[model samples]
Target: MKKIALILLVFMASAACKTNPFTGKKMLNFYGNSQIFPTAFAQYDQFLNQNKVVETGKDAQMITNVGQRIASAAERWLSANGYPGYLKDYKWEYNLVQDETVNAWCMPGGKIVFYTGILPITQTETGVAVVMGHEVAHALADHGAQRMSAGTLQQLGAVAGNVAIKDERTRNTFNQAYGLGSTVGVMLPFSRSHETEADRIGLQIMAIAGYNPDEAANLWRRMKAKSGGQAPPEFMSTHPSNDTRINNLTAWAPMARQEAAKFGVTSFK
Candidate 1:
């Protein structure tokens, strides 16, 4: 079982690679949009049905507008950079929910949701653009599929470890240690890196879409205050610290403007 698991892992690693056009890095993504999108779309549809989906409102319209602009900007960048059909299979949809959680997320194939609680912090259309770009970046980069693939491999590895350990006491100890090591040392860092990448890519795309990239950091500043310094430690969390994001976005703002300049987007909203 252990050997078979090892072989499967190796095969998956070799067979499932997709290049991230924004970063020029190869990502492990065993599932493509065909494999992941329908499920996400259905889940997103069910979520919308179960939640209070706001319609015929300014906030909802803003969400849709910002999402479309950010997605178009990403598509423009992809097309210009030799990935012309990168988003051909993506069916983008954006909806605003009447939840007070102050959060937003995008599913595997561009299904997006914005909770009304975030509006106070966002406070403007450009602020929505900032979040919209980041969420869209997740879809563009196929982070969802990659995460699912990684999760499957992680579970398989756990099973393989248990199978190889005949001694009950040793197996129990290994399970506990493995869980902590993998979550903290591997998964947390992996998620943080993805957040950082999305920050940079989203900044550039938003800039290209005629939104000020500098506001990205300002938005995070509001997020930090909203958190009241209550977030988990960076190493234990799945995302980078607010301070880290503020600093990185501040530094990347100028680069994003440069990228926007290439598209003749010299002014921002």
Candidate 2:
């Protein structure tokens, strides 16, 4: 079992290397859109049906518009970089849900949802664009699939450990330790890296979509103020602190504009 686990890990690491065009980094993604998108689409549909989805309103329209523009901008960037039709398989859909959670998320294959609670934080259309771009970036980067693949490997490791450890008490102790160690040391950091990457990539796409990349930082500032400095420590959490994101976005705003210039987008709203 141990040998099999090692072999599987090696195979996945070598065979599942997918190059993320925007970042120039090779990501480990064992599942493709074909495998993941349908599930995400179905789940999204189910959620929409179960929840109070705001289907017709100015806010709803604005959410869809920004999401579409961000997705288009992402496609333009990809096509310009010699990866045309990269999003052809994506069935993009954006919706606004009537919730007070102050959250927005994008699923695999471009399914996005924005909660009503976030609208106040995104005070303007441009602010909406900032949030939309970040969510769209997650879809474009195949983060959902990558996370699923990573989770699979983590479970496999646990199974291998259980099978190899014949002492029942020792195995139980190992499981407890391994769970904490892997989650904090590996999974949390991995998730934080994805969030940071999404922030950078989202900034560029929002700029190209004619939204001010500088607003990305401002949005985080609002988010920070809204949170009231009550968040888990960065090292212990799966997300970077609001302050870290604010600083990173501020520094990257100029570069995002430079990227927008390459696509003939000189002015931003």
Over 1-269, each residue of candidate 1 has an lDDT whose tens digit, in order, gives 88998899889888776899999989989897888999999999999999999997888899999998999999899999999999988999999999999999999989999999999999999999999999999998898998888888888889989999999999999999999998888887988888988888899999999999999999999999999999988999889999999999999999999999999999999
RMSD, model 2, all Cα superposed? Answer: 0.9
Please report how far candidate 2 places residue 71 from its true position, in Å: 1.3
Task: Give the distance in Å from residue 269's predicted Cα in candidate 1 to where it truly belongs.
Answer: 0.8
Predicted candidate 2 versus true structure: per-residue lDDT over 141-236, tens digit per residue:
999988998898888889888988999999999999999988998899999999999999999999999999999999999999999999988999
- Against the true structure, candidate 2 reaches a TM-score of 0.98
Model number with the top lDDT: 1
Please report how far candidate 1 places residue 242 from its true position, in Å.
0.6
Query: Which parts of model 2 are misplaced by more than 4 Å?
Result: none
| Candidate 1 segments whose C-alpha is farther than 4 A from its true place | none
> What would you estimate as the lDDT of candidate 2?
0.92
